[model samples]
Target chain A: MITVSIEKKLRTYGGGQALKLAAEFLTGSVTKIYGPSGAGKTTLLKMLAGLVRPEKGKIVFNGETWLDTERNIDMPPQKRKIGFVFQDYALFPNMTVREHLQYATHDDAWIQRLLAVSNMTTFTSHKPAYLSGGQQQRLAILRALATKPQLMLMDEPFSALDTQIKIVLISELQHIFNELATTVLIVSHNLSELESFDGNVLYVGNQ
Target chain B: MDLSPIWLTLKLAAITTLLLLAIGLPLAWWLSRGRSGIKLVTEALITMPLVLPPSVLGFYLLLAFSPQNGLGKWLLHTFDVQLVFSFPGLVLASIVYSLPFMIGPVKSALQQLPVSLAQASYTLGKTEWQTFTCVLLPNIKPSLLTAIVLTFAHTLGEFGVVLMIGGSIPGVTRVASIAVYDAVEQMDYSSANNYSLLLFAITFFMVMAVFIFNKYHAKSPLE
Candidate 1:
């Protein structure tokens, strides 16, 4: 289980907005965080992943202290072992689709399996620029899963896909998440899109 | 025709380019990561060479290393080394003279890349240096090429700095540019033309190669 109580300041157009929240996520549970624009949903994901720092917080994952501002114990992102799917996809233009997976892990069998699950086996040699938006998005998800990370944080991960692809991809990924028993937190503006996943909903608001 | 000047110029340009790459890459990486008053001031100093006259730098180098100034005198006494009117002095001048060419494009290219690229690498458990070399630097290949070409060419074409710091000493201090001037002063039009044509041709090919390569491999929009 991962427990977090954190506060961060957001630089909004209006003024400085404070984001404070406390929650506990059970191991192997999938949760969706929905909020309006500028609601700091992404910031929360970043803080959890150790990409962003919380001004005041204590985050404990499976009894490991990832962050404790009062104790001055903050784990870096490299040590967090969280798989992140960025909002922009953030694919490396220089690397082929297969290389992205190869960079994450050396298990060729797992890499081949991931490519097959994403239906990207035929396009493994292609760079991100050559892939379509949906293809790029799928590649991003597969790359994140390459490590088989125990915790996954995704920010609007499927905004580019059509309904059919989204439905199929999520279904495929759910099986893998269950197999790995990964705890997943996904942020999205539209919660209905994730209805098929049937995960618990967490609503975030800016203050 | 004596070709030592041509060889010496090539040697200088090659050494300077290598040395600058070693120093400039890390410096540019550091400077691109953030903004601070000190960083801005350092960037301005690096960029000053682009606008300031080369002779200004040449004059300062000459004064500081003339064996009369304290630093020069100390070096001369302690290390028995002389910088004034020497090939080493010419090298010092070229590095300062060509610094901006090596730093500008690299810093700008690094800054232009999406910040998410590095963050993504970090989440993948990659180290900061690995992210830079494996992810960031490869995306900025064209910029690195441009920086290297411009620095080499600019160093090859240096005149005022070489002349001010290193007087025309054959085979040691006299480079092709100074050779051309020396040839012209003696009304040796043929030798001057030879040096000028060779320097022009070398620079032309280096620059042309960069342009052609960049056209085919321009920095991608995604980068």
Candidate 2:
């Protein structure tokens, strides 16, 4: 179970204001963060990932208090056990696909499964730059899963891929999620992508 | 052709380049990621020696490291070390003189890195140091090479700082640049010509190698 109630401010076009005004989420199950662009979706994800600190609030995940700014308790991102797939798919450019998958996991079997599931076995030696957009996104997803976190946060993971590749990878992702039972929170402006994801959605907007 | 000065210059360049890399990498990382005000101040300080005449910088360093100064006194009494008119002193002065050559390319390379890369590494359960060594260092290879070559070449050709602090002590602080100057001053045109040609050839080759490598494998910061 994850529970978060955060209040933070952000700078707007000309001035600073309460951009993330009173955001709240209480979920007993895996959830998705569905919102349009500039809707503070990424901000909320960053906060949940422990990358950003809320001005005044608490974030409790799996009975552990990850953030309590009032109490001066803030766990860093590494301790949060939350995996984030960046919008640009921040794969280490220097590492091969196999190394990327290997970085977050100790289980060779699981890595093999991930490579086979993502259909990246053939290009395991290639760097991220050599992979296509869809291939990179698939590698990013698999890399996140390699960590075996309780929750995964993906920010527009498929925004860069073509329609066909997006559909195929999404199905593969659904199968992997079902098999691992890993909770996921994906942020995307694409409503159709959210519809395909088998999870509850957090619709974020201005109050 | 006297090979001693040539050997001395190579040794100085190698030592100076190694020292600069050790010192400059962390300094560049801090400057790249620090707050704007701090960054500005440090940037100005690092580049100050670049724009100023090397003689002026060397003069200040000489005073600071002289036996009369507090640091020099401590070193002399505690460690039995002297900074002025020594090979190590020449190295120390060369490091200061060639600091910007090491820092500039490194700073720019580190600055061009997207914060997302580090953040991603953090999210992957790596500490700041691990991320810096594994991800940041590898990505900035070109810049690191440039820093090494430029700092080495700059130290090889260093004259003012060596002249001011090193005092042309043969077999101790008399590096090739100072030796070349001494040769010219003594009107030993053949030896001076030999040293000058050697320096010119070395610097030309190193600079040419950097440009060629950059041309073939120009790394985009995003990559």
Interface DockQ per candidate: 0.80, 0.71
TM-score each candidate: 0.96, 0.94
lDDT of 2 by residue, B26-136 (tens): 999998885798788878988998899988998898898899998878899999999999888888888888999999999889888888888888888889898899899
Tens digit per residue, CA lDDT, model 1, A19-117 = 899999999999999977887899999999898898999999999999999999999999998999999998899999999999899999999989988
The residue ranges of model 2 lying beyond 4 angstroms of the native Cα positions read A12-15, A21-28
Model 2: per-residue lDDT, tens digit, A129-179?
899888898888888888877778889888877877677777887776666
Worst-scoring 10-residue span by lDDT in model 1 chain A? A10-19
Scored by DockQ, the top model is 1
**Against the true structure, whose lDDT is highest?**
1
Model 2, position B100: C-alpha lDDT score: 95
In the range B28-113, model 1's lDDT, one tens digit per residue, is: 99999989999999999999888878789888888888898987899899999899878887888888889888999899999999
With candidate 2 superimposed using the best TM-score fit, by how many Å does residue A152's alpha carbon deviate from the native?
0.6
